[model samples]
Target chain A: MQGGVIALVAEAAGAEALGAARGLDGNAFVVTDLQIAYLALGRIGPVVTSARVLGTGPDGRAGAVVELRDAGAGDRLMTVVNVSGVPAAVLAGSTR
Target chain B: MTSDHPVDRRTHVSDYFRLERWELPSDGGDERPSSFGGRAPIDDHQRGAGGGLRTGGLLTNLDTLGGFTSGLAALPRWIVTTSLLATVSELDHVGPLRFRADVVRRGRSSVVTALDVVDEGAADRHVAAATMTCAILDPRAMVLDFARPFSLAMPPPQADPVRPEEFFCIEPGAGPVTRLRLADQLRNPWGILHGGAVAMLADEAACRAAAAHGADASGPNGLAAADAVLHYLRPVKVGPVEARCQVLGTRAGRTSVRVAIHDVGAEDRMVTLGSVTVLAV
Candidate 1:
């Protein structure tokens, strides 16, 4: 789950972060770590995940932490820390 | 003069013990073979002595989940479990390893079984549990061509290890640590380190670190992960990690420890944190 989130957030963050960021297809996030603290059991549709981009680096590695929640109730479910590496080739999706 | 079966004095005790210990001697003959290639041969005695050593004791049955979890801390625990289970029953793996087998109930095929592995240590601190169902398989039992073989190399010792250490140790002068590089092969179908890589990474670090923690110069050490549930907090890029394993303690035959996979950088963030327990086999 963390790996998928890393790919999601890295690609999303890269696409959303300004400068030499953003994933090539908005799907190439390479996760390095995922620290999760379970808050509640998610038992509904479309779990909402909000990722806070930590930062990027010159070494192709990146980091972020995402909070998962129940989409309808907005109750926090799980927190995941994500890390990824952005390749230089796909570094142009972000206009923010 | 050549035989897979060996026998000797200890064999004699066991043979004699078998004569008195239990009515069932695996050998149907009145006398157990006393040496390898039974010709009343002398060379067979030395080798067969080791055979006698093998028949000493049976492992005690674990009764509670806590003790069951504790018993699993030793790798050999499941060897007896799986062997006995496989000898009599069948298993089906639903996920990577969550398995279901029939446990013994009241009648025909009376046993059923299911097991789940949580790699991370449970908050309850139990590592894992493998449940088994037992019932007599009739001569008329229809054999089901069950599942895939779950074979694995036992985790190596704390000294010189055979596994690849994926997490790198980049410290300039901090003694010896395992170095694992993520260059070409680590990439997934998507050209990045795969999620599976993290487990491989965790395995390499945990087993090797166990060896380094418990093994000595003689090297015949055995300390492998009793329990490990991984949470990929971040993805490892093309760089290396300095795998650090801090020994917490060793009790009975188990070793409890903590591990942090860290990259040598400014943030110095720990990519993975694990509480693992290993026991000598």
Candidate 2:
């Protein structure tokens, strides 16, 4: 459950970062990739995620790396993820 | 092949994937650094319930090509993968996927590679993005020899190599634990358990643990693996590798799991750490 939540939050944060970087609405983007490294177990509740835009592809694809922490556990590091968001229209003809 | 390590006499995990290597030109016309890639057709046995290549199988291919790319960058020395991470955006891909990998950073002790897979049959649409990190190490007694612009072809077909689970003969040991013995065919060029084998073992352990923990309560549909993040801390040099898993939690038909792989013959030292997510089908 936490893994799914972490993925969702990272995607949202990555979309926002990319939207801000490219001057586009965040809602126009969708997460396309996510690669995470689990550093420590998060035993506490209310996990938080932070994102930083790395670069934007010429085709409007944006990449970012996100870090997740446990807010209830003294903000201890939990996971580091590399995520990418692309224009939602790109999936128009996708089979999956 | 070294007398102590007869890796060449046996088939490798890469042979099953059937990836055809290609010679790549220098990046940006620079001669010092270069990129390499290959292509492979998606096979029926490799598909999951979602009609796409399974994450574990895909990761195996990624590890193969990415390892070669990084190894080339660290010539005169060798590398053992430390971690592997990837996300597949498009699962239902057309045939013949192209894989490209290039060195991201080449340090004295570590090398990182950026890996990308695109559907060649779908106008090169993005399919997956991944990264591999390897620790640089001296090849001590091992020999290092390769023809520059290195290229290799898929080994001759061998009566249809079975799926990984079949090849490894994975069997459930006890609650939330799975075991597989180290067979010669399961070793990599380094004479160690192939990284892909490690991934398959971890994936199986997570699936079994998640299901036992109620992830399969959804009905006969059962659970399917969604993603995997593996950190290979050390190589397994001994036999009878074991994977122990624990379900962290489940919600909305999604289960999160953690797995620890240990070399049972090597004093039970942990060899790899993995986290997996499974979705109810």
Estimate, for each residue in B17-132, the C-alpha lDDT of model 2 and write its tens digit: 77777557575664345688888777777665445666677788888888888777887898889998865555556757889987766778987777778889888876667778
- Please give me the DockQ of candidate 1 compared with the native complex: 0.01
Q: Positional deviation of B239 in candidate 2, in angstroms?
A: 2.2
Per-residue C-alpha lDDT of model 1 across residues B1-281, encoded as one tens digit per residue: 12355433112211211211111121425222111100010111111111110001000111111112222222222211211110100111111111122111112322223222211211211112322322222323223221222222222222321112211111232222434455444443233343333434444455566666653223243433433333335545555655567766554333555666665442656665554444343
**TM-scores computed on chain B for all candidates:** 0.37, 0.88
Q: After superposition, how far is residue B36 of candidate 2 from its true place, in Å?
A: 1.4
The native-contact fractions of the candidates, in order shown, are 0.00, 0.07
Give the distance in Å from residue B214's predicted Cα in candidate 2 to where it truly belongs. Answer: 1.8
CAPRI-style class, candidate 1: incorrect
Q: DockQ values for all predictions?
A: 0.01, 0.09
TM-score against truth, every candidate: 0.31, 0.74
Residue A52 of model 2: what lDDT? 61
